[model samples]
Target: MRIFSTILDTVTQRLMSEPVRHDPAALSRIRRAMIDLMPKDANWEDERLRHRLLVAVDPTSLWFLRVELHQRLGRSVGEEVALESVQALWPLFEDSIEPALLGKRPGRRSNNQRGDTPPGR
Candidate 1:
């Protein structure tokens, strides 16, 4: 029974350790979704991001691009909309990134958290 359990664990680890293979079409869809969030009158930064997305060959590249996307969207559309749209992309990256990392939203802090206090208060 112990040998059987060990073999099962080894098999499970092997399967889990294998790298996730992303489909080209799926990458394209994610890219398109991000690009759709861009403003109609895209600035140089937006153009650069668009180019990066076009040339990106893996899920990690697209994953990091979410930061730039959130910033651009926040500035152009407002934080609420930006947060929603960026969060929406998390599901699409499920197979690519660790689930634990996806749950934490950047810049999210409670009012009592450090640095949240305004100056001159």
Candidate 2:
């Protein structure tokens, strides 16, 4: 599992290192799909932010993310994407997408998502 994730992360990083001018709608759809596919206990904030940064800040990762999002969009619209359209993306999502998320850690919910404030803050 870790090996798979490492490969995916490396690929994602490499892809994120090019120029992408993707549509906002596609991104929105991707966000929605990701939300649905993700486990509720997954680290949504970090992974979501990372994906967004890949699209906005990193040009390399853009097309792959867009294509992945597009495939999910196609499914929603009852369209079918060709296999070659994005064969490499799903594995990465399965493996590398949430490397830091293994399950809800202690206090994660209370400290991060809940309204409760941390002691330092």
In terms of TM-score, which candidate is strongest? 1
Q: Each model's C-alpha lDDT?
A: 0.75, 0.44
How do the predictions measure up, each by TM-score? 0.63, 0.25
Cα error of candidate 1 at position 45, Å: 1.3
Candidate 1 Cα misplacement greater than 4 A, ranges: 1-20, 100-121
Q: Estimate, for each residue in 54-105, the C-alpha lDDT of model 1 and write its tens digit.
A: 8888777888888888888899889978877887776677666554454434
The root-mean-square deviation over C-alpha atoms between each candidate and the true structure, in angstroms, is 9.6, 18.3
Model 2 regions more than 4 Å off: 1-20, 43-121
Clashes of 1: 0
Cand. 1 Cα-lDDT: 0.75
TM-score of 2: 0.25
**How many clashing residue pairs appear in each of the predictions shown?**
0, 6
